[model samples]
Target chain A: MKSARPDSQGHFGPYGGIFVPETLMEPLRELTRVYKVAQKDPAFKKELDYYLREYVGRPSPLWFAQRMTAQLGGPKIYLKREDLNHTGAHKINNVVGQALLARRLGKTRLIAETGAGQHGVATATAAALFGMECTVYMGKVDMERQALNVFRMESLGAKVVAVTAGQQTLKEAINEAMRDWVSNLRNTHYVLGTAFGPHPYPMIVRDFQSVIGKEARKQILKAEGRLPAAVIACVGGGSNAIGIFSAFIKDEGVRLIGVEAGGLGIVPGKHAARFAGGKVGVLQGTKSYVLQDDDGQILLTHSVSAGLDYASVGPEHAMLHDTGRAEYTYIEDADAVAGFDQLAQWEGILPALESSHAIAWVVKNAGQFAKNDIVIINVSGRGDKDVQQIAEWKKGQSTK
Target chain B: MKKTRVDQKFAALKKQGKKGFIAYIGAGDPSLDDTVDIVLRLEEAGVDLVELGLPFSDPLADGRVNQDAAARALEAGATFDGVMNCVAKIRERSQIPLIFYAYLNTLYARGFEKAMNEAAAAGIDGFLILDMPREESGPYRKFISAASLNSIVLITPTTPEERMKQIVKDASGFVYCVSREGVTGVRDSIAEGARGLVGKIKGHTRLPVALGFGIGTPPQAAEAASFADAVVVGSAIVNKFHNNPHTPEGRADAAAFVAEMVKAVKAVNSPL
Candidate 1:
C-alpha cells in the first residue's frame, strides 16, 4: 500500500493536520486508506459520474451576464450555475461522494454540522436515498433562522439537533458534530460539510467536489472556445471555491479569486475574513488562518450570510494564499447586499448569500478588467433562503 | 504533599481491585454556590476525581444535556474567572483530584500560559481542553507542564495506532478513552469495540486509561472497570441537574443524583 504520508499527516503548509484525540486515530487512518483506494477505482468514478449526470443535473450552464458586463464595461462575466443542481446548491456533489464512501466502509449512520442548512439538507437527502440513519447538528440560532431547512431535513428523515453553545453558529455546530462522532464511532460516519477539518478530510472533500471544476473546464472551453482569464468563488470553508479552482489549478493563465465575507467591516471581531484579518492558529480539527483574539481564543464572527460566518478558512485555501496560487480578498456586508440587489434586478437571479460574496467582489472590480477578458463566477447556490433576511435588512435600512 | 495525594489515590484504587469513577459536572450549573455544594457531595460519595466543566457559550463536544448545563451556568453568570473562583472554593473542602474540562478558546482567551498558572494555583489537578488533541499539544503541553498541571488527553476508538502511541507519550495523569463516536449520553450498554480499544491502548503505555461517554450505572462502571483503570460518567450525572430544570431545588436534586451515582460506583469498587 502506498504510504499515507505527507497529505494524511495534516501538514498543508502549516494549515492542516490531525488535531483530534487518540481515540479517533484508527478510524481516521482507516478512512484515509479506504478513500485513497476508492479514488482510483474506475467503478467508483463511474458511479459518481452517473449520479452527477442523472441525479444532480451536472454540466450546469455557463451563461454570460451580458447586461451586467456591458454596464461595467470591463469584461464579459460568465457564471457556472451550480445553483441548478438538484438540491439547489453545489453542496450535494460532495455529500453524495462521501456518503457512498461511508457505505463502502460499513458505516450505517450519517452525521453532519450545518451553517446555512445547504449541507445539512444535502446530507439528509443522501442519507435518505442510501438508507442510512442521519443526524444533523445546527446552532440554536441557526435552527431559528433557517427554520425552513429544519423542516426540509426532518422531512427527509433526519434528526436535527440544536447546538446552543458557543457563537450559536456554524463553528459551534461543527464542534458539536465532532463530539458526536467521537461518541458514535462504531456505526457512524461524519459527513463533513466542507473542505476543512482534520487531515484527509480537507484533501478528500476537495477531491470529491472537484467535479465542479472538471465539468466547468470542459463547458467553459466549449462555450467560449477558450479558457477564461479568471475564476471566482466565494470562500466559507472554501469547498465550492476549491472545487471550481482545482481543475484550473494547472492552467497557467487562469487566475483564481476567493472572496471571503467581510461582515460590517474588517475591524477586529466584526468579520469572517480569515485571510484579511486572521492569523495562524488551530481550530475545529485543522490549523489554518483563524480569526482569534490576542490570547488565541477564536472570536465571535459576524456576517449577514449565516453560511459564510466561519472563523477559519479551509486549510487548502490557507495553503493557496500562502503559496500565492490564489488571491484572497474580502467583500463587506453592504457590498454583498448591493450585489444581491443587482443580481436580482439585472440577471433575474437570486444568489445564495454565501455566493454573493463572490459577486460583490466581481462587481467591485469589474471596471478593472479589459472588455475582451472573460471571467467565470461560480454561482454556488440559489438565494431563496436569504430572501427573508435580505428583505428584513432592507426594511431596517429603509426605516433608518 | 502533591506527590502524597497522587500516591494515596493511586494506592486506594489499587487496593480496591477496581478502577476509580470520575464524574463531570458543569460548575455553577443552577448557581455558583450550589455547584460548590455539588462538587463536595460528589467527592464525599466516593468519586475518585471530579471534572468541573467551565461553562462557555460554545461547548462543541457536548450533547444537548451538557449543552443546556453550560447555558444555564453561563446564564447564572459563570465566567472563566468565576469558574476559577469556584474551583478555588472546591479546593477549600476537597483533596479529591479535580480536572477542569473546557474548550481551548476559553483557556486561549485568558492566555494559555496564564490560564494554566491560574488553574494550577486555583487547586486544579488537571486540564482537559475538549477541542484540542495531541497533534496541537505543543504550546499547550509545554505551558501546562511548566505549571505542573496534568493535561489529560482523550483517546477515542477511532484514533490511529501511530497517533495513539504519540498521544500516550504526551498524556499526563491519565488517558480519557471515549467509548463511542457520538457525544456524551447515557447508553444502555458499553460499545462492543471499547474492550478491544482498551487492550490496544494498554499495549501502548502504563498511563491509567479511563472509559467514558456512556457509563451511567454501577454495573456499567464495573463492566468497564474490568478492563480499564477508570470509568467516567458525565452526561448521566448532568441529566440529574436537568430533572429539576434550572431551579434551586433542581440544583439540590442534581447534587443528590451525583451522590446516588457515587454510591453505585462505590458498591462495585468496595471490598466485600
Candidate 2:
C-alpha cells in the first residue's frame, strides 16, 4: 500500500518541502526521480533486501524483557533488539539502502553528518563495503564527546571533518555538510543521517528504515499472538520512531508514542521539547516544528545524548502530531540516566543514551498499562560508544 | 499610491543610458547605527538601489560572508523592529530604492499582514525571500501585490523557460537573475550560464532584469552590466564591512568597494 505523504511537491501536510537554494533544486529533483524509479524496480528491492539481511543482519530479535517486565508488575515489555545489528545500532539499516541508491546514481563519494556518530560510523561502514570515498562532518564539541566513534569512522576509511560553527553541534554539522553537498554535487551523494531534510529524503529514509517495524510486527504476533498495545521510540530527527511507526500506522489497535529529549527541564531554553515549545518554521530544507524565537531564529537545545540534541523532529512526526495519530512526549535527562542504569543492571543490555530515553518513558509509564497489554520499545543502538560519557555523567552525579 | 523608488530609479537610469547597482549588507552587523552609516555611505557612493538583509538564524542560501554577517547581527541583537527602524532612518535621509531581503521563515514569524504594514510604513519598496520557491510564494505575492509593494522573484539558469514565463508574471519591481547555481559569494569569473539566463528572462518579462551573486570585482560588474539591466553586488561589499565593522574605516572600505562597482556599472554602454 502506498503511504499518504509528501504529495507531488513533497509536503507532509504543511511541514515538509524543498526549501533549498536553486543550486540544489535540480539535484534534489534528480534524486527524487531516481528514488521513484528505484522504488518501482524489483532488482533494486532485491538488492536492498539482500544487504539488509546478509550484511546488516535483518530481523533483529524481539526479546521479551522477562526480568524487567515481571519487576514492572504490569504490562509485558518487549525490546525490539536493533542493538544486535552490525555496527551495534539500527543506523546501518538506513545507510545500507542509501548507499545502494548512491551507487546506482553513479556517485563516487558519500558525505554525511553525525551527532552521536552512529550515523557517521554506519555510513563509513557502508562506504567501505561499497568501495566509495566517504567524508563525515561532525561538530567539534561532539567530536570531544564522541571521540571513540570519531576514531572508529576514521579507521573505517572515512575522513571526519570537524565543524566549528554555531554551538558546534548536530545543526551546525548539517549546515557544513549541506555546504559541501552543494559545492560537490556532481560526484558526491549526501547520505542524510535521519528522516529529515527536504522532499524524497524524509520519505526515502522512512521507507528504508521501516524494516524495523515490519519485522517487529511479525515477531510480536508470533510471540504474543496479538499486536503491541503501544510502540515507542526515541525521536531526534525521528528516524527510528518513524521507521517503527510506519509499519503499524494502519493497524488501529497499535498506538505510536514518540519520546523527545526533555533535557534538564521544561523551562524556557533548557529542553529539546519541540511540540511543547516550538512553532512551525523553515530550516535546512524542510519546514517542520522547530524550536525558534519570535524572530524565527533557531534556539539551541540541551540533552544528555548528542543524538537527541536537535531543534526539530521529522516532518512526519509533525504531521502525526497534527493528526493526533501519534502521541509526542518527553522524558528528562535524570529519568533517562536512571533507565540507562537500570537496563544495564536488569537486562544486561547497555542501551545508548538515545535509546534510553525511550526506555525511560516505558519505565515510568509501565505501571499504568493493563496486565494483558504488551509494549515494545525500540532499542535503536548499543551503548558501546556512550560508555565514556555515561561514566563521566555518573561521576558528575556522584560528585554533586 | 506612490510610485516605487525602484521604478523611479530604473526609469531615470534608462534615460541616462546607464545600468543600476544594488548594494547589500546585513543589518545590525556590529550595530544598527553602523548599518545606518553603511546605507548612507553606499548611497553616497552612487549605488542605485540597496538590499537590506534581515538577519535570519539559518540562512541556507547564503555563503560564508553573509552567514557571518547575519551571525554578527543576531549576536548584536538585531531584531525585526531594529531592521525596520534602520530602514526608516535611511528613508529620512534618501529616497533610494530599498528591498527587504530575508528568508521566508523570518518573514512569516512577524505575521505577514503586520509585517507588510510595518514594512510599508517603514519605506520598504519590495521583498525577496531567498528560500521561497515559486510554488510557495502565492500568499506572500498576494500580500505584496495588495500592499502595492514589488515582489521580486529569482530566475536561475536551471529554471525552465515555461516556468520562467510564469515566475516573471508575479515580478513587480524587477526580476532577480542569480549569476551562478551556488549560494551567494564572491567569485573570480561570472558563470557562463548567467548571460544566457538574463537573455531568457528578458524574452519573458518587460520588467528590468538585475543580475546578482558573485559580481564582486569591477570587471565582473561591468561584464554583468553589459548584458543585464542592473548589477547587484552582495558578498563583496559585505566582506569589506564585515572585515572592519567597528569604525569609519569599515564603512570607508565598503563605500570604496561599492564606488568601484558603481563606476564599472556606469561605464557599461547600456543597450537598453
Candidate 3:
C-alpha cells in the first residue's frame, strides 16, 4: 500500500507546508522538480551508494548492548552505531546525498544552518569532497559552545557565519541562512540539515536518511531473527529519529519512541519538549508544534544538548504525535547526564548528549519490558563535541 | 465589495495623478503610544499608506534593521492584541490607509479569522503577509475577503513570469513587487529589472504595483516611483525612529524623514 503522507503539496496532516518568503518560492519549486528526477535515476543511486560505502562509511553496524541490557535487567538492547559513521554522526548520510544532488543541479555553491555542528561538519566534508564552496550559518552562542565542531567546519574550508539575532540560537541561524539563500539563489543550494522545513525538504532529507533504518532493519533480523519490540531515538529536529523510523512505520508490532529534551523541567521556557508545552504554530518555513507564546512568538528553549535546543520539531513528528503512531516522552537534563554516564561506564560508549536522552528513557522504563524482548536505540552521534560542556557541568555540580 | 481605506486612498492618488508613498515601521517598536503618535505624524507628512509591521520572533524575510526592530517590539511586550490596540489608538485621530505587514504565524496563532476580524475592527485596511505565498494563501484569503480586508499579494524578482498570473488573480489592495532578490534591507541602487518586472505584472493584472524591498532612501523611492504606481520604504524609515526616545519630538523627527520620501515619490511622473 502506498503511504499517503506529506501529500503532493508537502503537507503532513496540515503540518509541513511552504511558509517562506515569495522570493524563495521559485527556487524551492525548481529544487523539488530536480530532486524528483534525481530520486529515481539509477545513476544517481549508484553514485550515492558508492559514496556511502567508500566515503561516509555507510551500513553502520548494529551492535548488541550486552553490558547495558544485563545492568538494566530488561529487554535485549542494540545500539544502531550511527556514531561510528565518518564525521562521527548520521548527518553525512543526507549531506552526501544532497551534495551530489547539488552537483547534478549544476549548482556550484552550498549553504547550511547548524546547531550542534554535526551537520555543519558533515556538510563541510561533503563540500570539500565535491570541490564546491560552502558556507554555514551558526548562532553565536552555538559557535561558542560547539567550538570544536566549529573549528572542524572551518578546517574543511567552509565559512561559518555567526548569527547574533534572536537568542543567538538555531532558529536565528535558520533565519540568517534563509536570508543568504534568497540573496544568492542563482548558484547556491541550501542543504537544510534536518528533516524539517517546507515541502520537499522533509521528504528529501527523510529519503536520504532512510539508509539508517534500511540497514538496521536487515541487520536486526540477521542477529535477532525477528523485529525488535521497540525502537528508541532522540528527537532534535527529528532527523535521526525519522531516519530510523521510516523503515519501521509499517511494522504494526514495533513501537517507535522519540525522547525530547526535558531541559530543567516542564515549566515555561525551561524545556524544548514541544509536544508537552507547545501549540500548533508555524516557524522557519514549516507548520508544526512549535514552542511559542500565545502571540505566536517563538519561546526561547533550553537544553543541555545544543542540537535539541530548538523551538520547533519537524512536521512529520508532529503528525506522528497527533496520530498516536509513535510515543513521545521527555528526559530532564540531569537525567540525560546520568544516562550519559551510564552508557560510557556500562557499554563503554560515549553517547552524544542528545542520544543520551533516548538512553535515559530506556533506563527509566526498561523494567516494563520482558527480558527476551528486543529494543533498538539509535546512537545518533559521538559525544566528543559535548565532552567539554559535560566537564563544565561536572565542575559546576561539584562547586554547588 | 466594500471600499476599504486602502482602496479609497489608492483611488485618490490615481485621481490626483500622483504615485503613493508607503512607510513601514514595526508596531510598538519602543511603545504602543509611540506607534500611535508616529502613525498620525506619517499621515500628516503625506504618507498615503502606513504598513505597521506585527513583529514576529523569527522574521526570515527581514534584514538586520527590521529584525532588530521586531526584537525591540517584542522586548517591550508587543502582543498581537496590543498591536491591534495600537491600530485602534491610531484610528482615534487619523484615517491614513493602514495595512499590517506581518508574517503568517502571527495571525495563524491567534486564529486567522479571529485576527482578521479584530484587525478590520481596529481599522487595519489590508495585509502584506511576507511569508504567505499564493500556494498557502487559500484559507487566509477567504477570511480576508470575509472581513472586508484586502489580501495584498507579493511578487518578487525571482518570481517567474508564468507564476505572476496565479499570484495576482485573487489579490487585492496592490501588488508588492520586491525591488531585489533578497530580504528587506537598504541597498545603494534599485535592481536593474524592477521596472521590467512591474511592467510584466501590469500585463497580468489591473492592480496598482508598489515597488518595495531595498528602496530605502528618497532618491531610491523616487526612482522606484518613476516606474511603478507606488513606492514602499521600510528599513530606512524603521532605522530612523527605532532608536529615538519614545516621545513626541522623536516622532516628529521620524515624520520629517518620511515627509522627504513622500515628496520625492510624489514628484515622480509615473510612466504609467
Span of ten consecutive residues with least summed lDDT in model 1 chain A: A1-10
Best model per lDDT: 3
For model 2, the stretches where C-alpha displacement exceeds 4 angstroms are: A1-3, B1-3
Report RMSD (Å) for each prediction in the order shown: 4.2, 1.8, 1.2
**Tens-digit lDDT track of model 3 for A8-127:** 778988799998889989989988999889878999999999999998888899999999999999799999999999999999999999999899889999999999999999999999
Candidate 1 lDDT over residue span B95-133, tens digit each: 888888877766766778999999889888788887776
* Local distance difference test scores for all models: 0.83, 0.89, 0.91
Report backbone clashes per prediction: 29, 0, 0
TM-score of 3: 0.98
- Model 2 Cα lDDT, one tens digit per residue, B1-272: 45688888888988888999999989898779888888889999999999988998777778889989999999999999998998899889988899989888887888887788799899999988888877666666778867768888888776778778888887888899987767889999999978888998999988999999888999999999999999999999888877765677767876887898899999999765
Overall local distance difference test of candidate 2: 0.89
True-contact fraction per candidate equals 0.62, 0.40, 0.89
Writing each residue's lDDT as its tens digit, candidate 3 over B214-265 gives 8878898899998899999999988888766657787788888889989999
Per-candidate DockQ vs. reference: 0.41, 0.55, 0.89
Instruction: Rank by TM-score, highest first.
Output: 3, 2, 1
lDDT per residue for candidate 1 within A1-400, as digits (tens), equals 1111235486677668876655565677788988988988999989988888898888788878988787678688998899889888999999999998998899999999999999999999999999999999998888877788889999999999997666789998898788888777889999998999887788888987898898889988887799888899999999999999999888868999999999989988799999999888777777789897654556789888889999998988888898788999989888899998888787989999889889889899986677889999999998987888888878888999
> TM-score (chain A) of candidate 1?
0.97
Per-residue lDDT of model 2, residues A1-400, tens digit only: 2355678778888788887765677778888889999999999999998998898888899999988998888599999999999998888999998998899889989999999999999999999999999999999999999999999999999999998778888998998888888778879999998999988889999999999999999999999899999999999999999999998999877889999999998775688889988999888888899999998888988898999999988899999899888999999998998999889988999999999999999999997689879999999999989989988988999999
Better of 2 and 3 by TM-score: 3
Model 1 alpha-carbon miss at residue A239, Å: 0.9
